[model samples]
Target: MFAALAAVAIFTGFVDAIAGGGGLVMMPALLATGMPPHFAFGTNKLQSVFGTTISCANYTRGGLVDWKGNWPLAVLVFVASASGALVVQQVSTRILAYIIPVILLMMVAYLIFSPRMNDEDAHERLSRVGYTPVAGGIGFYDGFFGPGTGQFFTTSLVALRGNGLIRAVGNTKLLNATTNWAAVLVFALSGKMIWLLGLSMAAGAMLGGYLGSRFAMKHGARVVRPLMIVASLGLTGKLVWDWFVS
Candidate 1:
């Protein structure tokens, strides 16, 4: 069971590090262990922090990330995510269970309807004021609901800031990592994280992170778009099933 779960985690980490939906992999694997839903979610966050951290580092080393323009956004995301995670225990997952399907449907629609969006040579059109609110809001969302946060950040940076898809994805890694670490702290303090499972998954995630980042760098935005679309659709299916069947 452990070996099989680890294999799945590695694959998920790679896909997630590149495109931003590893939860699709990690969550189910953890739940398969018979952990409660809440604990599974929390533990996923813990493992994801390490995966994303490795992703961020890999992207940074590749010169795909723009840290100078993104540091402020990271700070805002950290604060907002921490606050949201702190409050997570008080909220009902049933609310998310209902809302996620709707959100996933919207994401699929956008991915399908939007004219192909690629920014090979995009110049910035957004100021800090314009982006700060968006960063903080999504950071809070990451902590509150926890799935699809990467897609949201990627789309926002691409549409609003005029970043190319690949750059946006790379930058999203850093910001998402920031939010994940913030949530991890809260989950850790609450003893909601399962270290054995999380670490086992993290090992796979780290390898996935490196491989995924490389794939993203090699292929660029055009290649990632279809993958993102597929992941989003799968996410929609998963959320809908969880909502209706659970």
Candidate 2:
């Protein structure tokens, strides 16, 4: 069981470092261990924080991240993500859940088929003020529903902010790492984490994150774009399944 968890973490960490939405992949392993859904969620957050941070660090080292200019947005993401976690308990997400897969499917199609897509920065459409809403929207979604946050951020950076795919992916890792911490702290305080296992999986994730970021840096969009499509499709499939059964 422990070996299976570690192997899955390595794979998901690789996928997550390149794309996002590894949670759907990780959850089944946690559930198979007889963990309650909420507990599995918390443990997932706990393990993911490490992998995300590693990926973010690699991106920063590669100079793909713009921390000086984007720190405020990071702070905004942290606040909004935590707020989303709090607000989720008070809301019904059935409609939102049903809608998100459609959005993801469209995003996957565009990213995969768009001839216009490239690793070149284009005309910046949004100023800092304009991007605030985007940051808050996805951050809130990250905490509220917990899937596709990285893809949402990367797409916004590319389509809305006109960032290059590689840079957008790097920045996505930074934002996601920031977003994960908010969930981690919130879930930690709830006292549900399985520390030994979480930490062990996290160790495996670090190995994957490091290797994945390196591959992305070397191959650029060639690697990231397809993996993102896979991740988005994976999330879309999960959401569609949940909507059907629920």
Candidate 3:
């Protein structure tokens, strides 16, 4: 079971490195091990954060991250996500979950149709400062509830910041990595993790993240844009299915 899951972790990290829906694969694999749902979610964070951080590092190393522009937003994202984690039990996110599929579907359509979704930077529609509120909301949503936080961040960067798909994805890794730590902290405090499995998976995820980010930098927008669309569509289906089951 551990070996199989480790392999899944590698693939999860790869996809997550590109477009941000790693949980789509990892969560189900964890659940199949027969742990409780909280354990599954917590363990997911425990393992996936490694991939997120590794992917972010590779992007930053590739000179794709705008440190001066994005650092403040990263700090805000961390705080907002932690705050959301604190309030998660107080809120019911089913309504928001229902709304997400719609948003993801819209994102998929835009990705499929948009002509400007390339690697070259374009005219900024919203300044970095103007993006704080949206970034905060995504961070909060990731901590409080999520199936598609990566896609959300990537699309926002592309559509709102007018970042090309490549840079948008690179920065999305930074924001996505920031979003994971708070949830991991909350889950650890609550004793909701499978440490042995998480650690095992983390190793695979780290390798996968490294390779995936390198691949993204090598291939650029042609690869990332379609994967973003796939991520969005996959997430939309997951959220919609969950809504129906719930």
Candidate 4:
């Protein structure tokens, strides 16, 4: 079981390192191991944080990150996500259920129809005030339910900030990694995480992140779009099925 999950984690890291939906792979794999659902989610976050950190490093090394103006946004994202984690028990799953499908479907549609869109360079289109709310909201979403956080972050950077696809993805990695780390910390404090599983997944994710980032830099959005489409549809299917079954 550990070996199987570890393999999945590597692919999850690679995909996530490039485009931001690694959870679509890793979380379900963790859950399939027969752990409790909440434990699976928490442990997935624990492993994912490391993969994301590795991805962030890879992107930064590739000169894809803009840390100077982004720190404020990152800080806001971390704080808001932490707050959301604390308040998630208060939010109704019914609301999330109604909203998530729509959002996921929309993301899938965008990836399919707008193949030519996505910035090819790095430039900030949103002012600090303008982006604070966006980042905070997404961060909150990440904390509350994180399956699609990376896709949302990637889209936000592209649509709102006019970043090139590569840069947008790089920036998304940074933000998502930070949020995952915050969640890990909180979950650890609450004794909600499974360390052995997390470490195994982390190993896979790190290798995947390295390879995926390198592939993205070489291939660009032309490759990413199709994979994004597939990942989005897969996630939509999973969520819809889960929603129905649960």
Write model 1 residue lDDT over 1-246, tens digit each, in one string.
667767887888888877788887678878888998778878888778888999899889988788998898899999999888877778775777677768777776766676545647465567767889989989998887787898888877877787788888889999999999999888888888888878887787888888898888888867788788888878878888887687
Candidate 1 Cα misplacement greater than 4 A, ranges = 123-125
Better model by TM-score, 2 or 4? 2
- What TM value does model 1 have? 0.93
Two-way lDDT contest, 2 vs 3, winner: 3
Give candidate 4 misplaced runs (Cα > 4 Å). 89-94, 122-125
Q: Pick the candidate with the highest lDDT.
A: 3
For model 4, name the residue pairs that clash.
119-164, 119-165, 120-164, 121-164
- Quality of model 3 by C-alpha lDDT: 0.87
Error (Å) of candidate 4 at residue 72 is: 0.6
How high is the lDDT of residue 100 in model 1? 73
The root-mean-square deviation over C-alpha atoms between each candidate and the true structure, in angstroms, is 1.6, 1.5, 1.5, 1.8
lDDT per residue, candidate 3, 63-149, as tens digits? 998877898999999988877776775666678878888988888888888887888888988888888999999999888876789
- For each candidate, what TM-score against the reference? 0.93, 0.94, 0.94, 0.93
lDDT of 3 at 229: 84
Candidate 1 weakest lDDT stretch, 10 residues: 115-124
Collision count for each candidate, in order:
0, 0, 0, 4
Q: Estimate candidate 1's alpha-carbon lDDT, on a 0 to 1 scale.
A: 0.83
Q: Write the per-residue lDDT of candidate 2 for residues 36-128, one digit (tens) a residue.
A: 766787788878888899999999999999999889999999999888777765676678888899899989988987764578988878987
